[model samples]
Target: MVQEIDKLTDNVNDIKSLFRTLNETLESIEKRLSRLEKMDSIEHRVEVNQIDLSDIKESLQRIEETHSNEIQHINRRLDSHLVKIAKIEEEMIIIKSR
Candidate 1:
């Protein structure tokens, strides 16, 4: 009877050991799944940033075009002012001669 009790105890211990191992395996799997979920989130953010960068590039191009046109217009105005100054200088010189 004592030997039979010992055998039953051994069986119970074996079952407990198997349960612990299974629990550890399940925990490892959960950790791996968490890492995969985090990676997916990072990938989503990267994709969103790529789209935003493209939009920013387009906006910058438009700004450059607008500034270029403004600069051209200013240059033309400056040229006109310079011509007016030259005409006034010529008139002043003639008046001084008299």
Candidate 2:
């Protein structure tokens, strides 16, 4: 009878050890899953940020093009005025000689 009791006790201890190992494994899996979830959230935010930056870059490029066009227009107007002034100066000199 004593031998039978010893065998049962050993079986119970083995079962307890198995239960402890299983619990530890479950806890480790939960921790890994939480880390993966956080990584996914971070990746999504990065993608969103990249999209926003692209939009901003496109807007800035458009503004730069508009400013360049305006500058060209002003330069053309200044050139026209300079030509008129030169013509007027030549006419004044011709009249003085006559």
Candidate 3:
């Protein structure tokens, strides 16, 4: 009976040790889960920022295209006005010579 008691005591100690190892594994898993949650939050923010950046780039391109067209129109008008001024100067010279 004494030997049987000793065997039971040894089994209890083994079970306790197993429980301790299980607890440690659970704690490590909890830490890893927390880190993954934080990483997911950061990744979500990066995705949102990427969308915003694309929107800004599209808006800037539209603004540049509009301004480029306006500049071309203004240049055409200026060229026509310069030609008219030259014609008037030539007419004035002809009148003076007469």
Candidate 4:
């Protein structure tokens, strides 16, 4: 009977050891999964930032184009005014000579 009890005790100890090993393995797996989740989140944020930057760049280009077009229009108007002034100056000189 003592021998049987000894055998049972040994079997229980073995089972406990197995349980400990399984718990350790599960903990390790949990830690790895958490790290992977964090990495995925960081990657997603980076992608979003890149997209926002692209939109900003496009908007800036459009603004620059609008400003450039406005400057050209102003220059044309100035040129037209200059021509009219030159013609008036010529007419005044003729009248003065008369």
Compared with the true structure, what per-residue lDDT tens digits does model 2 show for residues 5-65? 9999999999999999999999999999999999999999999999999999999999999
List the candidate 3 regions with Cα displacement exceeding 4 Å. 1-19
Between candidates 2 and 3, the TM-score winner: 3
Query: lDDT values of the candidates?
Result: 0.98, 0.99, 0.99, 0.99
Q: For model 2, what is the C-alpha lDDT against the true structure?
A: 0.99
Error of 2 at 11 (Å): 7.5
Tell me, what's the RMSD of every candidate?
3.7, 3.0, 2.7, 1.9
Against the correct fold, how does model 1 do in TM-score? 0.62
Show where candidate 4 strays beyond 4 Å: none
The candidate maximizing TM-score is 4
The digit string of per-residue lDDT tens for model 3 on 22-84 reads 999999999999999999999999999999999999999999999999999999999999999
Full-model lDDT, candidate 3:
0.99
Q: Pairing residues by index, what is the TM-score of model 4?
A: 0.80
Better of 1 and 2 by TM-score: 2
**Candidate 2 has which clashing residue pairs, if any?**
none
Worst 10 residues of 2 by lDDT: 67-76
TM-score of 2: 0.69
